[model samples]
Target: MTVVNKLTRLLNITYPIIQGGMGNISDPNLAAAISNAGGLGTIGVGDLPINEAVYKVTEMLKQTSNPCCVNIPIAVHPNVSHIVQQMINLKVPVVSLSAGNPAPFISLLQQHKIIVICVIATVRQAKKAEKAGADIIVCEGYEAAGINAKNESTTMTLIPQVVQQVNIPVVAAGGIADGKGLAAALALGASGVQMGTRFIATKEAPYHKIYKQAIIQATDESTVIVGRRYNRIRRLIRSEYASKLLEIENKNDDPAIFFKQTTENYHKIGAFDGDIKNGFINGGQIAGLIEDCPSVYDLLETMTADAKQILKQSLEKLE
Candidate 1:
């Protein structure tokens, strides 16, 4: 079992692991499985309408008695207040806000006794979230999949800075896939680690086999950063579609075509329909480390075990 810590206690989870709210193609079954297995699972609210998101939350809640988190990208979804109200009405155990300023909604969620975790990429933003009544801070780095923070801080560099600056628990995200990565985050004084790309390769994720296989087959050089020219930096797996997207982003300064090609529908096409020719998949640099597709339970079990061993070995070596 993972050692008791502020994060686990705060989130009411056995492990200090939080799943990233993988937008659009998020699976309720996959989220519930992670929650049931001791980690905090999140239902990603991409651009889905409020009703559709509510349905997903309901399905995820029905499958797991444990606490679950709903990850909502504040700026991506048009109806932020409506969704927040739905979350309160549903009495969700946790809510993670990202892709926009969370200060406005933090107090509202706290009023209803809902735990709030803000995903940030800089120390200033981390402190801002804490000041805004956020219960936890998930500091994301540039190496993470999908849309990254505008500041582009690395998890290794951002974690300690956020921890030193914020009084609340800090969860390190970006480029983390296994136990050793978790151990490194803890060593940097983070309370836990949040993973996205790693969980996508799990058995319960319900994504396309081709997507999972791509993750398994990925190498250190397999991923590339796109959308930089349009000021929307995102990490994506290097594929024909991804390359095409990058080409458009580079040659075309106008965001019209780039935005059209990288919408939620395209993401679903790549992640769920396994269409790489016309759709692109999101992945982190950690994809290189994912060699197998295990069940969520087994993945968590092995990670905690490995983290414990790795920490112990490091301590011994220090002595």
Candidate 2:
């Protein structure tokens, strides 16, 4: 049998697995698919308005009676109050927060009885989230795709440290794509794992064909860190734009010009065309490990099976 924890029990899910709330990519269809496969699916509504956020939640619920979560990046979207209220009104069972504090909104949501999970990049932020009333803290590492903190910490060094500091359940993120990672995180005192890049590579994700192919073909050395000068570091697959960004950064180019050039192509290539070479391929180093694009069920099953095998092998050694 697969291991179960208090978090899994609380969320009424069979596995302590969750799909990370990735903006633009993690929508109702993708979120519902993850939940249907027995993991918590999170809808990222940071880019959407309050009305659209509510509609997205409603549509996700309609997809599966199984519970799902909605992630709100407080700093990027100022409609968190409305989003939280919408969650309460719509009765969303779980809500995850990133990029900002959830304190002011926590009480409001807790009053309606919502499970709150906060994404933290540092031990200090983890402690702050706990004090601010986060039910669970997700320690996202520097290896993760998307916007990572400037003072990025690797998951290997950060997970156990965050676990040691926070009394609440800690979910490990960044570069985790398979059962080996799941087992390692559990061993490090993490209750579960939250994965984004791995899921994006799956068939369920709404990424463009080019984007998915890029992930499939990528290796550890295929990605580069960009936008560090602006204090908003993101990991993207090494491409034309990525190379140019690095070149500009190395030249010590103007910050404003650098940001404009980098972001200008993000939507044109990634969002619209899915051109891997010129588009935004936000992904973790795990891109190197993912060789095939499997269905969500296949991936989850393999992870659970592998984790159980690892546990069994460890016990055999004890005997």
TM-scores, one per candidate:
0.99, 0.93
lDDT of 2 by residue, 1-319 (tens): 3457877887888777888877655578888988998899998886676777777788899998887898988887767777777788888999998998778887777888888999999999999989988899989999998778888799989999999998999999998999999988888899999998888778777778877888888888977788887786888887776787788777875787776765534634674477645656677888999898999888888997898788779889999
Q: Which ranges of candidate 1 are over 4 A from the true structure?
A: none
Residues 1-319 of candidate 1 have per-residue lDDT tens digits of 8659999998889988999999988889999999999999999989998889999999999999999999989999989899999999999999999999998999899899999999998888888889988999999988899998667788888888889988999999998999999999999999889999999989888989999999999999899998888888889999999989988987997898899999999999999999999898999999999999999999898898899899999999999
Report the error of model 2 at residue 197, Å.
0.6
Best candidate, lDDT:
1
Find the candidate with the highest TM-score and give its number.
1
